[model samples]
Each structure stands twice: as C-alpha cells, then as structure tokens.
Target chain A: MISLNLVLFISSLMFFIGVAGVLIRRNLLIILMSIELMLNAANLNLIAFARQSGTVDGQAFALLVMGFAAAEVAVGLALAVALYRRKDTVQADDINLLNG
Target chain B: MNALFTSIGHNLFLVFGLLACAGAAVMILSTSAVHSVLGFLFSMIMVAACFLCLSAEFLGMAQLLVYAGGIVVLFLFVVMLVELTKYKEKSLFTTQIKWSFPLVLIALGIFAYTMKSNLFDAATPVALSLSSGLAEGLSVSAQNAQMVSRGLFAGFLLPLEILSVILLVALVGALVLAKSERVS
Candidate 1:
C-alpha cells in the first residue's frame, strides 16, 4: 500500500520549495505562482487525509481551493498589470511606491 | 501478488512527485516570466495527476480545467501585456536566496524527522461512509463525483455560496484595479 506519509512528505517538500521561491524570486508573477504552489501543497495534504479518513469533505474543500485560486490569479494579475502600467516594471523589489 | 501492486503504486506516486518537484523548481528558478508560467503549468498538471492517484477524480479534473486552463492563461496574458521579458536578465532573483535555501533545507530536515517518527499515525482501516451510496452501474469516478457533490451541497453549501460572492468581488476588483483613471 502507498503510505500516506510518503504523500505528506511530498507535500511538505513542495511547500518548502514554494517558500524558497517566494523568498528568492524577484518577479511578482513568479511569487504569485509560488503562492499557488504552496496552496497546492496544502490541497494535496487535505486530499491525502480525506482519502485516508474515508471522507469526501477534503475533496470538496480542494474544489473550493481551486475556485479561490482562480479568483486570486485574476485579481493578482490585474494588480500586477496595473502596477506595471504605473511603474513600468514588475520587479517586486523595485515597486517601492508604497514604501513610506 | 499484492507486493507487486503496491510497488507499482509506489513507483507511480514517485513519478508524479518527481515531476511536480522538478516543475516547481523550474518555475521558481527560471528568469523569464513566460518560462515560469510554463513551469507552473507543468507543476499544476503533475499535481492534478497526483490528485488522480489519490482517487480525487473530480478535484483532479477541476484542477486541470481551472488551473492549467484558466489561471495559466491569465498569467500568460499579464506576462505578455506587461512585457516582463525586458526585465528578465536585470533581476532574476533576490539577494535572500543564499540564506533562504539553507533555511528551507533545515525545515525539510525537520519535516522528514517528524514523518519518520510517525506523528501522523492515523492508519486505521478506512471505513467509508459513502461506499453504500455507490451504484452498480456507475463508474468509480462517477460515484466519487456524486459523493463530492452530495457533501458540497449538504455540508458545504454555505461555503459554496460564499465562494460565488468572492469570485464576484474579484471580478469587479480586477476591473477597478486595471482600469485607468480618467483625468478631467
């Protein structure tokens, strides 16, 4: 049998990868993608546990997460575009307009 | 015989896991915004395949359609519209990579030790509540989907409704944010 631990390990690994991405990448878009990776890692954990516990609740939540992620991408990209329009740049460090 | 089956399943899981990890690494490390989006696509598809392995067929399909289809296209459009290609070479990564990588390694090490200790030892034989609802004529995916919807409409109705409102707000917020201010 495929142990749930292995699945959880993979999820944990992916989560850290996302953390690294968010910390290391300068691009706002890639940071958003990393955030998606982290969310996906969490969803993987939820689905894995749901399967183990014999419940459909986790699956439903995962579906909701997908919806939430889609909405997030829509708004996030729009903001990125607007920021680029204002600043002529998408580099996270350069967009310091809000730094007071 | 059971050993053979278990080995096959284990290998399949490893395959998808490796694909996801590799894609995530590529997404994180790539310089160009378009390349990162492509990497994100690969990672999302691999993650969806992992969901399929977990028997979350409905979620897997939704991940493919919503993520790979919708979110990726949005990212692509913004990447193209912003023309992030020009800034790719100037600032691909932050100065924090040197420290962040080591910190991540420590965190992963801690997680692996916890896993080895079996802190999540909930290995009781799963007694499924929805198994009785499965009909003979329906496929497994169909049965899973039915159970998911049943749960969604019953136990998760409020959250589903809330999600619709959230999507609506996001739509309007995107419009307002992206719209240029008209000067008199």
Candidate 2:
C-alpha cells in the first residue's frame, strides 16, 4: 500500500496548480476547469484518508462532492453561455461590470 | 517473482499521482480551450486510476464515468457552443501572474511545512477493510461497490437526499440561465 503522506502531498500540489490556473488564466472556462481540478484534488485526499482509516465514510463524502461538482459545472457553463450572449466574450477581465 | 509484482503495485500510486499532476499542468499551460479540456480529461482519468491504486474501486469507476465521461463531454459541448476563434490569437494568461505566482508559491511552502510536520501522525496506513457489522453475515471480501452503497444509504442517507435536492436546483437554475429571452 502507498503511504498516506505521499497521497496528501500530491493532492496538495494539484490543488495549488489549480489555484495558480484560476488566478493567472484569463478565460472563464479555464477558471472553471481549474475549479474542477481543485475539487478532484480534494476528492483524492478524501479517498486517501478513507483508505487510511478503513472506512467508506470518506468515499461517501467524495461521492457527494462529485455530485456537487457536476452541479457546479452545469451552472457555471450556463452562466458562461449567458455571459457570452450579453458580452460576446468569455474572458474574465471583461466581466468587470460590478467594478466600482 | 511475487516481490516484483508487489513492488510495482506499491509504485503505481506515485506513478499515477505524478501523471495526474502533469495533466493538470498541461491543462493550465494550453492556450486552446479544447486542448485544455482534453488535458483536464486526462488528469481526471489519471486521478481515477489513483483511486483504484488506493483500492477504492467503486469510487475510481465513478470518477471515470462521472468526470471523464460526463463532465468532460459537457465542457466540450460548451467549448463548441462558444465563439472561441476570435480569442484564439489573444494571450491566454492575465496580467496578475506576478502577484498570483508569489501567492501560490507561499501556499506551496505552507503545504510543504504542514506535510513535514507531525500533523498527520494519527493517519497511519491501514488496510482497506470494510466494516462487517454493517450487515448480517457481511463477508470481509464483499465487493467495494456493495460496501460503498451501505455507507451511503445507511450512514449518509440524509446528505444524499440533500444532494439530490441540490442537483435538482442546479438543473432548474441552469435551464433558467441558458434559456434565450423570447422576443416581445
């Protein structure tokens, strides 16, 4: 069996990579993808812990998270469509209408 | 020899973990939205393999089916729906990289520190053994899917119901958001 620490390290790295992508990427779609990456990273950690503790509770939570991610992606894509219709662009910087 | 197979099994986790990270990197670095979606698909599939490596067979299959099968297809559909050709020539990254890079680096440092510390001292490795008391005469070798189902339906029933409601709400909201305004 793999060390739990190694799994934690990998998940953390993936989470940070997702954060960097969300921060640096201009496209809204890419940002959404980055969010998915972060969610997957969390799921990785949950499964690793589930294995460590020899319980399926973490797996259950991970399943819920997967469902939540699906919902998130659906709403996000819909919003992206709405934004494209109104603004004719999907770049994150262009959606500054709320800027004071 | 059996030892060779065991060593391979032990190393598979590291291999899949690194591959998943590499796929994430590719997703972030790719300029084309389609390519980025492909990269995300690759990363998710790799993560599912990692789940299998950890013996979470059901979760691994669910990850493959839900993420790689459903979510990636949804992303691809959206990518096709949007007018992406116009933005193809523009720069992919924003101007905030200088700030965000440092922030991410700091976060990485903090994560490394936490990992190096004894924060996870309690999480010693344990074999993947299901709780036999979940059901009468539940064998130790019960299928992973069966065990996960017991966990979800028995232990997390309320949360699962709440999740179903959330999914319903998201479906309605997405429909409302995506509906084209009818011409008056």
Model 2 residue B115 CA deviation in Å: 2.0
CA error at residue A55 for candidate 2, angstroms: 1.6
Chain B TM-scores of the candidates? 0.83, 0.89
Best by TM-score: 2
lDDT for A62 (candidate 1) = 86
Please, what are the lDDT tens digits per residue for candidate 1 over residues B1-184?
9999887777787689889999999999876677889999999999999988887888889889889988888888887788865774585788887898899999889988878887467585363345444433444445777778877776789999999999999999999999987888
Candidate 1 lDDT tens digits, A1-100: 5578878888998999999999998888889999999999999999988888877788888888888988998899889989988888888899777899
DockQ (C-alpha based) per candidate is: 0.74, 0.78
The clash count of every prediction, one per candidate, is: 0, 0
Report interface Cα RMSD per prediction.
Answer: 1.6, 1.5
Query: What lDDT tens digits, residue by residue, belong to model 2 across residues A1-100?
Result: 5787889899999999999999999989999999999999999999988887887899889999999999999999999999998889999988898998
Evaluate residue B74 in candidate 2 and report its C-alpha lDDT on the 0 to 100 scale: 92
lDDT of 2 by residue, B1-184 (tens): 9999888776998889999999999999998889999999999999999998888889899999999999999999999999888987788799988999999999999988978886456557675565557844555345888778888898899999999999999999999998988989
Q: In terms of lDDT, which candidate is strongest?
A: 2
Query: What's the TM-score of each model vs. the native?
Result: 0.90, 0.94
